[model samples]
Target: MADHAGHCSSSSQDRRSHFLVAAYGYQGHLNPALALARRLARPHGGGARVTLSVAASAHARMFPSSPPGQLVVAPPDAEVSDGIISYVPYSDGFDFGARPRTAADRARRRRVSAASLSAIVRRLAAAGRPVTCVVSALLLPAADVAVEHGIPLAVFWNQSAATLAAYYHYFHGHEHLVAAAAAAYVGGADDPASVTLPGLPPLRVRDLPSFLVDATGGEHARASIDSMRALLEIVGREKPMVLVNTIDMLEPEAVALRAMRQQHLEVFAVGPMLPRLQLLQQTDAAGDDEGRRIDLYEQDDEKGYTEWLDARPRRSVVYVSYGSMLGYSRQQVQEMLRGLRECRRPYLWVVPRDGRDGDVERCLMEMDDDDGDGERGMVMEWCDQLKVLAHPSTGCFVTHCGWNSMLEALVFGVPMVAVPNWSDQPVNAHLVEELGVGVRAERDAAGLLVGTELAKFIAVVTGDGDEGMNIRNRASFWNQIL
Candidate 1:
């Protein structure tokens, strides 16, 4: 392996080399990538010139003042040091316009983004800030550009190390078993079979990522799986390092299997790269001074939820969020509302409004409280998730079990009632159960979360019973380590 430091320091210019970290524009992918970029550009020393890049539309949504197809350094924020790190936008075929609503549009955006990224790299190199390493967030095409320019590319696996290992094994040799298990699970309807991967525990067919084999998974899901397979193939052939957002202790067996079937494979567990606030508070540091959070959606004031939480009893509030992209059907949304209303617990739910679907809004209007003070439950488009998780009043989390949200729940020692939507969430939910940190709620035949089941699971995890206490203790143990 070539030493990266050798390329970083040149005789003519004795400065830190550049690291260009690119995320795929979704909130889940961008947050971890941004945290990693911040680490690379840490103020004191032993840091690099980090420039974070994302799709043009996402960049526009993040910074509305900036125009698309232009590369401009981010204006300095008081909390973020200016020169240490910067953000730039590149064309992803959506020039600050409406987001892509179809698979063909998404595919075109990916192709154009690849070309635009290559141009960005060339321009950066020409300007004397050659990128020493290109870190990509699950986007394989970016790696081709890096290879073309003879620069090392590192994949920042945004999901858990265990999930990555499962995907790798599936591509390497376990396809038949996984596919059969998925089919059996889909066929069984009531009681499904389990798929036993090489390094992980037995996962129910429902727990498998939808992209791998689920027939109902749409084009986007299929495209994601296809892209992931291509990514692993690139890793297998080119042998670039894989950097997973996980810790070794959390998934020892999975981490051990990181290089089981692939040659020249090197994997590093360098994460739980949470936001600045969560990181500081969890580390017992005094700084509560919040910095700019890498959120794509419009967010409410961070203090509102924390103040509301402060008034509640310890471990009494349920924090609910379904991530940035996943959307629920009208039936599903209504069921969740009914569950929260009947659960009789104070809750804070971040339900992002979907412009395409009026059902969510209709349901919200139907369930609006007469008092309008949000006396029992509060719903907003967005909230500071990390701050809410860290609050002492946050007892349980009702989450989609996306890797980032799952990690936040575990790190904060909050028990979970997981309602996994799709794509690696099932695996993450299973891991949560296996680790004894949380419990998975049962879904109906149509995979809709039942109001009764949601209430039952929430009560199970938040109740004052031995099982709940045990789960809480296990969560706390992990949080302490984190």
Candidate 2:
């Protein structure tokens, strides 16, 4: 293995390099890649020219240039799954925190488009920083470019490793099983049933997200899944590595799964990266604070939900968000709105307005409950999530169980109500429920939200229920430097 440090050159005459990251235009993908780009672009000693190439329109807003690293627009060819960040402000809780939905045809067209990656790379090459390593974020075109340039490629798991492993296994000749299990998964109309993977422990059919298999009953899904499978299978052929954006302690199963498959595919769990990234931002905040405030939000929303915690008691508000990319049905969204209304508890909900479909403001106005206690609710399209989790006023979290959101919850030691939307959320939800950090909620077909389940969820989150709290408390305390 070649030491990466050996690639680090000090001579100013030598052309500098940029960590070319493919973020695929979603918050989940772009956010992490941006953080990494920022990390790599940071100077070690005194002087070093650097660049951090990002692929989002919001980059200029969120990451203003005091550090002066490069912020490239996500190009056309860079388009992975979907090409555009919908006008839908990437809100939380609404559609399980996903970017707004678009037609499959447009998505397919965008996926095959060749405008972004090459242009960005060409720009970097033009900027005197020949692109070095390529990092792909599912849709981000890093892998394709990596193959083109013969540079090392690292596929970033924007979600959790558990789902990554499951999807990886899907491509490794589990097509029939995936197809069958996917049918059963699509059969959400029936009673929830368990389906087992060959190398995995038993999991419910509902545990698998529909997107992992061929939902179209066509080659695109199969080919896409197969492509990902082929990518994972042969990643080690060139001693390529897989980077799981979680800490070792957060998910042992994902870590174990990676080890089982191959040795050359090294798994480095260097996160929960956002927290560390935020911590780094704070470290750098003392002087350059004025120019680089975190941007990319409605002006008023700069005030975070957790800021309320400054006055309230510790762990008081239930912080709720479903990450930035989990899709949800309309019924599910309404259920959460109504359930929170009934729960009568103070909460902070990152509910994105339907930027395209309808007036999200209408949805908010319609769900208006005169609970009277300003404490009962705080809703927004998006929130500065980490600040909310880290706030002392946050007592509990209700989430769709995206690994990033889940780990952030756990890292902050907040108790949880886990709603496994799709992907590895089921596994993470079970881990949380079984381990005592959180509890799962029941759902119905159409995937609509249920209040009775929400009642149980509320009880569990509020400490009015059973043994779950003991686990959460221990986890919380463990996080307190113990």
Candidate 3:
């Protein structure tokens, strides 16, 4: 194996190839699917041939160089709609105000959920296998297409299975269990700090991540819930191979019970998906001298972040982002910038473009009051986020706690300050703080993050090793779990 250490094929080491409907306008949805694509492509040691047939144009961008690669671009025939499920070719990716994502936009993004199953069916007809296996994000045409083709289709739950189980239980007239808990703790507010399901252990509302908490407050939440419930119903009655992006050990009980009821459960524990999958592949290919090809997502950007990092100082900066879906009001955006500037911390913030016609760069500078360190607060319209976080100068992450970012922060053993806006964010933030890996921010009774609270949290993360290192130590311990 040493003779051919670096060379590898993109043929997917798995003995069997599988098709994946990998398409999403936003980064959060797109990144995990890419991670799963990478995982499936690597050899599973049993000579199982696995090739991920991603079904979309945006997805094609992710695997541009990787092989056994096929991207089923959105055909012109498929139309777009405002309320219906369809893909509107977003020449420009989704953008919210220089703030967090709004509820309606979140719903619209999820609504543009066209499953290009027709494309996949045709592809198989041309050259691929019988198309027996498929994984999807529970979109409309997903199961219908799979059924038409007589293929076994699995609704890949991108969120935690625990979250799915909660939704299932919620539909069974047991959702109040959470409403009651939220009422009891956060006082009828959507911000339920801790939630416990009947006959199940106590799961923090934060641990459930943000969406479950905020769904009650917004319109997108309803559409997404409808989608999730429909998905769970399909999984509930007829078991399609369910693929969840969580760990067996971390969420052992939930995983166990999910498999108990469902006949076809293949819980990969394959998460923190990007890095954990890499770990498994690296371990499996430990001493193999075979030629292996490079994975595309890990490829360097034009300028290269590592090179950028080398020019910056050690642990001297803060990272800020509201994730891909979350948007903020212009008012909230101002408060956030004021907080960052007041904190006196040099930061790299992903300032959101104003909704429709907003300018991203102008927003960042306007957010700066003092400009004490001109450009000390670097603003990137869109970033190679993973690479930026891995930079040594990055001391803390002020994030929306998307599953991908949570895993990325942990992989780098980087400390974080949490400000969960929506979806699973609240849950992610709670886990980040509760795990001792990241510090938490205090929000008011109305759930708005106080400016001082944001600044204070930032100071703690960028603070000295005595405190920050302690958080990093806890973060490193979790990294070991991966």
Candidate 4:
């Protein structure tokens, strides 16, 4: 295997090779991609020049005040830097924040973004900062552009290694096995079915990635399957390196890494890819003290959640957030509120107002009215999640089991009550339980977590019972190791 630095030139004049780190427009994709770029640009990590490229819409949201001229499809002279890493926006055709609604729309966006990204590469090369390598966070167009330019490419798998292993094996040879398991379970099997992949434990049908299990169901599910298939095909044919967003210690057996290695692919575990705020503070560059994390959506500034956390006792607060993308149904929201109220713990909940349905908003308003004193709970549109998770008073995280959220909770030693919805969340929730650091809440026939069930899991995670203590101990153990 080649050393990462070997991808750059050895000549003194061209020593500082540029790396183009491209991520999807979503917050979950952007955060870890930005973290990797920061690590590469940092003095100790590599001291390389890093440019982070995202869809124009996300870039615009991150830097809303930038001049129109600078946000052109491939602005050659536009150089926006956060002191450490440069920022670039490639036109994904849907620059107005509207998602691709159909197959044709997705194809058109891919075509447009591929051209825009190619132009960016050419412009960078002409400006003498040629991208030595392209690191894509599951963005297919970036991979296409990298291949078009003959530059090295590495995939940044932003999910758990176990999830990656599942996808890889599902595509490589075990498709039928996984499909059969899911089909049997869905067809009302008496016992739950499981698929055992190489190097990893048996993953039950319910615990596998929801997209793979329901690959034929919806537009989103089909699209996700297509993307994964495309990504795996690329890795299989070209054998490009893969960088997973987890530590070796976390996945000690290195299941996915080993599986990829057997196929002659170079896979590296480079993760817990979190913002190094302390390291950023020591840098000479002048940038945001928060490690230049790009939040595409507005955050709540009026709510003093942090100050409220400070006043709470140690390990006493329940922090609830369903991530930026997942919106709860009205019933789900009401049930969550009821559960939190029943838990009787001071809770900080982040429910973003954008994209929320009218019914959900009304429920939130009614909950606010009901809790006039705001003594037991505080609900905000959004808050800095890392701050909330790292707070000393935060004891439990009621989360949707997003990979980033799971990593943060693990890093902070906060036990979780996982309520997985879709995509890789179920697999992440499985990992959460497998590690003994959290418990997953069971949903009813309607796939809704009732108030009582939610309350029960929260108590199991945060209570003084033996099970809760064991979960807390495991969380602390992993926290120290990570």
Candidate 5:
């Protein structure tokens, strides 16, 4: 086995391996896939060459200054390398980040992406750099391309193993049971029934992945359930190896791995899949290469945020951010502001102007105008979350409980006030509480996490009380172990 320092012997075959990681264009999907690509490109991780593939829209966003040809639709052989991993873009039939309005539009994206990826594979092989494996981050078309090309495939499960287990059982043999439980709960059942899957703890209906029980049946909800079903179907038919983004110590029982392998599926827990500061230092020592971290959105000035944190007292600032893909309503945002003001804590909050709602922009502008000199609060469209969490002044995280955010909070030893919204966030929030590292705030009947509840949970996580101390201690323990 290779040590943390990448000191391990590799076979000649390992050195010749080239991994093509095809990631979905979303922020949550891109982060872990990029992290894994970086790891595989390292000397300790088989010293393999890696190529990251995403839609042209995301590629253009990440490298906006690239030439027009590269931004629109990259040539089959066009690739950018940051002295380590290579990045290539494939057209997903929606280069401007437009969502598909119909099923046919969705299918067109898959077809276009598949064709572009296949071209890239052939082009690489023609240049004597054939991809030895394909690792997909929920990009379904990548699986078809790999199969068509006869290359080994692996799916990167970018959520907790527990959620993976829930999805597995929900598809395998427990669909009826889960559906019944969810329906009953939604119908105001007093019991709020629990589901006991093999090799795992009993999970309440609320703890399951939100897509499974969402009553809205909106397009997004339907699309989510369909995506999960297709992914599971591929798992069952192809039995490709799975690389989960979770720590073994965190999931001691390994319920997902056990359940999958019982039917001959291969799964590996390869995580704390975060950027290593030491690795960044090493990169710095080599040169001024700056592509180690990739973000789809432009970030706030690093010096400005770090300087603000440096001036604050140790363990005093509250860092609040909902992950990308979640846009809080104007009322919710106002309530959050009220809670932050009432808490009387210095805070840093991220509110991205994704241009989806004009009201949100007006609210954010109002907030900026109110906090003139940023003495009590600072608002950024987006900021480097890992840097803020790693700062000593950051005492607690008020987050949407995205898996990447949860992993960052845990690894940085920061307690959390989980305000999960949808998808796997609810499951991640449940695990946060189960791990004793955070408190999940209770929401009102309309699923609004109002000001009082938010303020109370913030205090519970960062206060001097016994519960706060225990949560902080557990967070520290996990941090050390990782």
Candidate 6:
């Protein structure tokens, strides 16, 4: 195994493998990408070096104390080790703050990032440690940059293999079918019927990615669709070996279709990439040395959430969280609060400070005061979510169905009540329902979750009912497999 002190040895240094990993700026995308990068860089006979590259704006958020830059290595507050993994920040046009709004802005940022990443690859090659291969996480431009540097490219599919197959078919053969269905549904303004892809399970129109079914998403949706198509097209031409965050036994059909050479692609199921929690059980052969979690936001649990959780009975607490980016309307917030109150379960909720903190804080205060027993529910800005999920008290997770969150829920054997907002979340919700691991909460036509429906599903999933028992058993079954 290689250590920081071994950097001085010539033979040991010569044997080190180097991989350049690039991920999009979003938190969901970065978490999986970095986790994979860490796994690749774990201690071994021959050492490994990983370079995590991200857009400048995201870099700033990850390490807010770092100075502005074009292409810089080891910015202040970057979590880097001497001989293991390192951080490299790149320009995405919007370096200071905010994401690309329009297609032109997105394209411009891609161009800038491509040039900067090419430079990083060149710099590494110039230094005696050439990058062996480039693994990109949802940032399609990184593939072109890797090719330009005369290196092999592997796309890290940040979502599930099922979603991968859906996109794969969309670009290969099912484009017209999906487009026509979406158009017809849009015209009728009726609930969309389920659509089937080649060699895959049937998916409701709502189960498909929002970019495919919802035209009202405007420029963002169109841009996302274009990027997804472009990514598949690139893979078909380049024939790069793809890596997905799923296992073979879990989604056999999707994995088989993914590796079909007839489509000029080969895919590998290499993940469920997660933080190996030493407290519960160890998954990797690396023992309990899982190291620090890769977090963009600093988590300060001033409320002692872990202590609160420690006092709860086993499998008694409900954990609720939307992902990093999703925010709720005030009405929806009240509905969730009402549902939690009605469910009569001990709960821990994460309420982010995205303009509605005051409302959420007030709600939490009211809920706390109304409790005859102390602290029926706890709310914090953020905490170590993976740790919370791994806790014994965590029985159910109320999730946004983001792929990372779903993967964690599966790992921890926690059933979910999915509240899908947009993007791939709806597809993941469909997967949760299809897999029979959990049930989706019912929503109205406008896509708002009803309080009574939320409370009812919570009772059904958490109570001793037959359906709840089945879901719980399936969740425990997957946890053992994972």
Q: What is the C-alpha lDDT profile of model 3 across 1-482, one tens digit per residue? A: 11111112123323444454433334566556545555544444232223333333443443343343444344423333222112222211232112115666544543333334455456545664444355665454455566566666666667665665566666656677766665565554454435665324567655554445563666667656766676666666656655667776656656565533543433444455564434435644794312222222233342643454556688777888776445565556667777877788777776544321354334555655455443557655456666566667888888877767887788777788887666666656766766688887877857677678888888777777677768878877866776
Alpha-carbon lDDT of model 3: 0.56
Q: How would you encode candidate 4's per-residue C-alpha lDDT over 1-482 as one tens digit per residue?
A: 12454443233324377789998999999989988888777666667888999988788777766564343233433558878889988888888778998999989988998998999999998988888888889999998888887888888999988888889988999999988888888788843635888767877888888998893579989988897898789888877788899988787664446766888987788888886435344432664544556676667773477778889999999999988887789999999888898988888888887647999988888888898756778888877787777778999999999999999889878899999999989988988888999999999989899998989999999888999999999999977876
True lDDT of residue 212, candidate 4: 85
CA RMSD, predictions in order: 4.2, 7.2, 8.5, 3.0, 3.2, 5.0
**Candidate 4 has what TM-score?**
0.93
Off by over 4 Å in 4: 7-14, 66-77, 191-193, 254-256, 276-290
Model 1, range 301-368, lDDT digits (tens) per residue? 66776678898999889899988777767798788877887778998988785522787777766666
If scored against the real structure, what TM-score would every candidate get? Answer: 0.89, 0.76, 0.74, 0.93, 0.93, 0.88
Local accuracy of candidate 2 as per-residue lDDT tens digits, 253-356: 55667443554455565455454434635655764321122334443254544455576776667777776555445555567767876766677777654331
Please report, in order, the local distance difference test score of every candidate based on alpha carbons: 0.76, 0.56, 0.56, 0.83, 0.83, 0.77
How does model 6 fare in lDDT?
A: 0.77
**Alpha-carbon shift of residue 239 in model 5 (angstroms):** 1.2
lDDT of 5 by residue, 361-454 (tens): 7887787788776888898878888778888999999999999999989988999999888889988898899899999998899888899888
lDDT for each residue of candidate 6 in 1-482, tens digit (9 for 90 to 100): 24321321223454456778898887788878877777777666234678888876677666555453432333323444434578777766667666888878989988988887887787778888788778878787798797786677778898888788888888887888888888877777565556788656777677888777776868888898898888888888887778889888777777677335556666778787776555324533444435445565557573588889999999999899996787777778789888988998988888776635666667666766776434788876677888889889999999989988998998889999998877888888987887778889878978789889989989988989899999999999888988
In model 5, what are the clashing residue pairs, if there are any? none
Model 1 per-residue lDDT at 401? 97
> Residue 360 in candidate 5 has what lDDT?
78
Of 3 and 4, the candidate ranking higher by TM-score: 4
Stretches of candidate 1 exceeding 4 Å from the true structure: 1-15, 43-45, 66-81, 101-103, 189-194, 258-262, 276-292, 370-372
Extract clashing residue pairs from model 6: none
